[model samples]
Target: MNILVTGATGFVGRRVCARLQKSQSYNLSSAVRQSGSNPPGSEVVIHEVDGQTSWQCALKNQQVVIHTAARAHIMNDEVADPLAEYRRVNVDGTLNLARQAAEAGVRRLIYISSVKVNGEQTPAGCPFTAEDAAAPADPYGVSKLESEMQLRQLAKDTGMEVVIIRPSLVYGPGAKGNFATMVRLVAKGLPLPLGSIRNRRSLLALDNLVDLIVTCISHPNAANQTFLAADGEDLSTTELLRGVANAMGIPSRLIPVPAGLLQFGATLLGQKALARRLLGSLQVDIEHTRKCLNWTPPLTVEQGLRHCFEIRQD
Candidate 1:
């Protein structure tokens, strides 16, 4: 199979390329920006991603395209028009790539979306499923949802297969953002006030997500389907922190603080949104993916955490 993966140097994209290169069945290529370098042993094509950007050179002879590039969610966006900026990349850029891929005779296009397309949080004991109506709460989520819709329409018009995988918080070796911050705090034995946060959030390991992406590449049943990817295990804030601490071979020093107080404090500090992510529930149901794809996460949560810790040590 001739596969072309965008965002080939990104956290998830790098891992995807590594996995695909190891498989003897694939002849891998990377579609990167002019500024980005190609992964070793893979063909590279440079093209800008924008309204006027062209992907003809990259899409040639490519059977599958795994799009992992995007204008990621910004925590404190200083831009005057955040939505427009996101749309320029997430929606417009994505659709442009899909249209060209379809015209180039590509067989499948796997889009890596986010669970935020469902909503910010799930009510207690309820997990977001693939069938749930999209209720994206942020601009990034909205753009992703719009791109998914556009891709489906294009698929219908071109007879090209489209497979969408919406994954929850993805973490593993070299993870940054909130997960990395938590790892640092835990390694330092800092006292965290999230002991009272009893919310359950689903997390996807990088390996698990990559595994599912690889599965979607040629799976006959995956065409025109949207699948939610997760580790099939949910953890509370307290449990997650403690698990990280355990993996680091340190004691977790968590101080019990009421979730309400935490929210209030975060609001005063202009971090209410961050507080919601830390204390809220965001669970996903991957039963459809498991049953439909006959797939299972190869790594347990503990094993994933251990991999992360070992990477940190190196």
Candidate 2:
């Protein structure tokens, strides 16, 4: 199999490349952003991905393209017209690459989207599913949703298979953003006020997500399907903190702060979204993914956390 993986230098991309390389089965080609950010096997160094970017050179002889490159979602962006900035890369760039890949006879293109496409929070036990109507709440989510629509249409128009995988808060080795911050705080034995947060949030282990992506590559049932990927186990903020403490073999240092008080403070600070994220439910139902791809997360939450923290020490 001739597989081309975009975002080769990214957290998930690097792991995907490494996992694929270890197998020594597929002819893996990694598309990196810069010159020196190589990932083992064959490399295609594309400086930037945008509307005007050309991918014909890279798409040649590539059978399956795992499109993982995109402008990551962030709370604060220092760019003017954040929406345009998002569209430039996420929307325009992805479509351009897809179009070229289709023309270049790429058989499949798997898009790594976000669970944000299904909306921010789900009602208590009602997890988000692929059947749910897309309700993107942010510029990044909107851009992703737009890209998904385009990809699906391109799949219909051209005979290229497009697999969409939306993963929840991904965590593991080399993880970043909120999850990384939480691990660091727990490791430092700092008092975290998330004990009172009874919210259940879904998380996707990096290995689990990579496993799903790899499974989707050749799975006939995965063609033209949008799958929500997660570890199948949901955890509350308090439970998560305690789990991290247990995983680290340290005492759980958490304060019982009221959710209402936290929300109030966040409101005053104009961070209501951040507050909801900390004290709300955002779960994803991976039943469809399991049924469709015959896949299950290969690692438990504890195992994934251990791999992460252990790697952090090195």
Candidate 3:
């Protein structure tokens, strides 16, 4: 099949392209803003993903589009209108591509979305499901939700298949954001106050997420369906820290500070958002995805963490 993968330069996108290249079943091409970033000989320069960016040359004769491009989450963005910026790139750009893909006779478009579309947190024993009402808390999440809605409507009108996969925090070697920071701290053997944080969070291994995207590429059940991706096991803050430390073959120097005190300090220091992410209970239920697609994460949480560190040591 002829396939076009967007955002081929990103972390997840890069991995997807590599995995697809290994398969003889696909004639792989990648969309990028720059040259020499994708696989050698399959790069299509589609400048920026926006409402006006043209995808005609790239979409010609392509059967599937795995869109992984988006304006990713920003920690402390100082922009005047963050929501507008996010919408312009995430929502507008995504819909633009989908419309053009449908016009070009693209059969399927698998969009890589975020679990943030389900909201910020879930109570204990309660996880966000694909069927839950969208409750995006931030501009990025809102834009993703908007893109998903637009894609669903476009699918309904154009007779195209749209598969949306919402994944929780994704981490592996070279991961950024909170997971990276935690890894650095654990490597240094610094004492962490997250030992007492009892909140569970869902996480997706980079490889597992890539595997899911590949599976959905031709899975009949994935068409016009929304799936959540995760490692199936939820880990608490303490469990996560220890897991990393153990994987790194080091002692975990975690302090038993109460979660409340940690949050209070973070609030006073204008890091409330950071604290919530470190101590929040964000979980996702991928049961529907498993039942519908007959799939399972290829790695357990511990195995995933071990692989994450093993690559770093390499």
* Candidate 2 clashes between residue pairs 3 or more apart in a chain or in different chains: none
**Please, what are the lDDT tens digits per residue for candidate 1 over residues 1-314?**
99999988888998999999999999988767754485744656656676677888788899999999888877778999999998999999999999999999999999999998999999868999999999999999999999999999999999999999999999998888889888888888878898878999999999999999999999999999999999999999999998888888899999999999999999999997788889889999999999999999998888888887787679
Candidate 2 residues lying further than 4 Å off, grouped into runs, are none
Worst 10 residues of 3 by lDDT: 32-41
Where model 1 places Cα greater than 4 Å from the true spot, the runs are none
Report, for every candidate in turn, its global Cα lDDT versus the true structure.
Answer: 0.90, 0.91, 0.93
Clash count (model 3, backbone only):
0
Q: Per-residue alpha-carbon lDDT of model 2 for 1-314, expressed as tens digits?
A: 99999999899899999989988679999998888776866989887899988888788999999999999998778888888999999999999999999999999999999999999998779999999999999899999999999999999999999999999999988787888888788889988887778788899889999999999989999999999999999999898889888878899998999989988999999998778888889999999998888898999998988887787789
Give all TM-scores, in the order shown.
0.96, 0.97, 0.97
* Candidate 1 local Cα displacement, residue 275, angstroms: 2.1
**lDDT, residue 18, candidate 3:** 88
The local lDDT score (0 to 100) that residue 104 gets in candidate 3 is 99
Better of 1 and 3 by TM-score: 3
Check candidate 3 and list the clashing pairs.
none
Candidate 2 RMSD to the real structure: 1.2
